[model samples]
Each structure stands twice: as C-alpha cells, then as structure tokens.
Target: MMLSGLDHLLAAGLVVAVPLCGSWSQRVLERATAEGRPDARMRDYHLTMLTLWSLAGLTLLLWGSAGRPGSLLGLMFSDGMRVLIGAGATVLALLVLVSQWHGISRLDDAGREQLAAQVGSVLQLLPQTSREYRTFQALAVTAGICEEVLYRGFLLWYAAVFFGVWPAVILTALVFGVAHLYQGVAGVVKSAVVGLLFGALYAATDSLLWPILIHTAVDLQAGAIGWALRGARRGAV
Candidate 1:
C-alpha cells in the first residue's frame, strides 16, 4: 500500500512476472511431453522462447517506469555505488561457495551419482543445449538484475519511505521470505532465510549490485559443488 513511483512499479513487476513465466513454462513442457518425441532440443527451444518473452516483458516494465521516450528513470544509485555492491557480491559468493564446496555435507557415492544424474537431465549436452544454456544463462542474469532491483532495491525503498529504517528492513525481509513460496517447502524455508539475509545485506549496503553478484556466485558455487561430487563419483566407478 505504501509503494509508489518506480519503486512500486518494480515491485509490482516481480510480484506478477515470476509466477506467470513459470506457469507458461509448465504449459510448454506439458505440450512437449504430449508430442511424443520430447527431445531435449525441443525443451531447450521452449526455454529460449520463454527467455525471449521474459526479456520482452522486462523491457515493457522498464519502459513503463520510464514513462518518457529516450530517457528513463536512472538506477536508484550511482554507478560507483553499484561497483561497490558488485565487489561485495563477489566476496560473498566466493565465501559461500568455498565454504560449501569444502563444507556442504555431501551425500555418499550413491547420492552423488543420483545428484549427478539429476543435474544431467538439465545438462543441455547436444547442439541445441548450448543455445538452451545461453537462454538459461540469460534467464539467470535477468533474475539477478530484476529480483534484486525489485526486492532489495525497490522494496527497501518502499519500506523506508512508509516506515522507518529498521521496520523497513524487517518488512522487506518478510516479503523476501514470502516470495519464495513457489520454491516448495524446503526451498521456501531456505529462500526465506537466505532472502532475509540478502535483504539485510542490501538494506545495510543500499545497493542491489552486491546482492545480484552474490546471488550469481551462490548459484555457480552450488553448481560447482554438484559437479565436483559427480566427478568424484565417476572416479570411484
């Protein structure tokens, strides 16, 4: 209710977009399965299409926020500020990854293989996989940009504008927790905890760049850990 201006617009875009995009993807996957061939390439194509449309949606959102031709609302913070956030994000990501790589409690050999196989399903190993990979890469990048802008960037602004700094931070974190409901129970719990953590970081720092960078690093680190465990299992075999 307190949200207004560009802050409101961004928060609204996120609240609307993710679920719509995900649901569209579910439909596409269902169609691919029903078609009988169900090639990975086909799935990849759908993902590409999905990403393109998402990009398009993002453009519209940006344009709407701009409300003027050839000139738009500039980022909430300075470029210098963004660079610092980016630096913090890099540090946070490395810290989390290295910690998890060495410290993430691993499953046994069987579990490693199972995890590997699960990763393989989304591997995109074929000719089309590369494109699909790029699509997903873009999707990840977009997520990093939009989610941070929306949640930590805009939402933080709203909370501070309507409430005080401390309440704003707490409320933003609460929204962060609620935002992950689509991730399922475990995901929801994890995301909520992490969301609040990230939210707090943003509030303290007042930059989305750091959160975006950290988010990407976290994903990559998790991916690497899974890859390492898989490699170890293969070596065992």
Candidate 2:
C-alpha cells in the first residue's frame, strides 16, 4: 500500500522522535539510578515504556485497519520458511539465555558482586522483588511486540513506500540502532548489527514474527538475569 503524504510526515516524525525520546528517557533512568532510587526508576521506566509502546502499537493497528486489516496478522503468523527461521532464532535465543544464566550462577559472591556492579546501571531498572518480576516480564513482552510493530513493521512499510526494499531495510536498521543510543557506543553497534539481522529476516519472510520472538526472548532473558542478580545480592547482604 502506498503511504499518503500525511503518513510520510508521521513516519518521519516518529523516526526522529523515537530516538530523541529514548535518549532523554535514558538520562532520566541514569539519574534515578545514580541517586539510589532504583524502585522509583523501575516503576517509571516500565510505566513509560508500556504507555508509549501501547500508543505506538495502537497507531499501527489503526493504520493497518484503514488500509490492510489482516496484513499485520499475516506478517506475524503466516506459515512458511520464515516461521521456521523465527522458531530457530527463538531456540538460539533461549540457549543463549540459559548459557548466560548458568555462567552467572557459577560465579562466586565477589564475582557476582563485581558483575552486578558492572551492569548496575541497567540492573537498577529491574524490580526489587519476586512479585515485581512478573511486571518486568509483562514489560519485556510489551517491548518486544510494540517495538517490532513500530520499528520493523510500520517503519519498514513506510520507508518502502519511498525507497526500494533494501534501502528501506537499511534505513530501518539504522534507526533501530540509533534508538538504543543510551546503551552507549558498543550497545548501539550491537543493537544495529542485531537490527540488520532482524531486517534481513523480515526481508526474507516479510514477517515480523521471528524478530518479535527473538526480541522478546532476549528481553525476558535479560530481565530474568537481572532479577536473579538482584536476588543474589540481597542474599549476600
């Protein structure tokens, strides 16, 4: 479907807005963590993410409804090699999660402490209690779904209206990376590379299913790890 001029304007606005909003949010998170307000940080971070991403997802849904009602579902659940590829990626992500958990579990108290400190800034955004872990899980899943819908699904579709497929894919991947700028240079680079892989997968299958699965798995794994690390620190204390 061809994007209208208004659609193009909205897409352009999002492309610029998302990264700027992310950078600003990251600063807020960093400040909260540095100030020893982990609980507040966790609450605010999840709330903000859930609200913004929900709006984004709703916007995509509305757009899809107006033009191609079932297109989003088709992109997600169509049976094909793409589905197989997405499933395989999910398996790989799970394996990586398991490996990281196992490695962390093997660490001594001092090692674990050091590791926790190393990523303390990120970890500080996690829930401090087991109950809060459920909330974190919801947040992670929301992130996976909403982000894929906005970045991979909507953005790619919009870009493809103007640019060729490959160009759109590259542009989308770059923006995806830029959105994670708060993660620092290495994080941005890593996210960009991952984005490239996701873009390629989407191009291959024309589905957001695999990328969403992989992204959700990765986020949940990170949340689990952070929760575990927090528990370990509490135990040590």
Evaluated with TM-score, which candidate comes out highest?
2
Q: Which residue pairs of candidate 2 clash?
A: none
lDDT of 1 by residue, 14-76 (tens): 556655655465455546644744374446445644664565456546556656332122243
* Candidate 2 wrongly placed segments (more than 4 Å): 34-38, 72-74, 117-120, 231-237
Q: What C-alpha lDDT do the candidate models reach, one value each?
A: 0.55, 0.73
Residues 1-237, candidate 2, lDDT per residue (tens digit)? 655665666577567877787778878777776687747655665766776586576666668656776454325564677678767766887788788888987888787788877764566666667767888888888888777777778778778777977888888888888887777776677788888877777777767877888888888877787776885556644
| Residue pairs clashing, model 1 | none
What lDDT does model 2 reach?
0.73
Full-model lDDT, candidate 1:
0.55
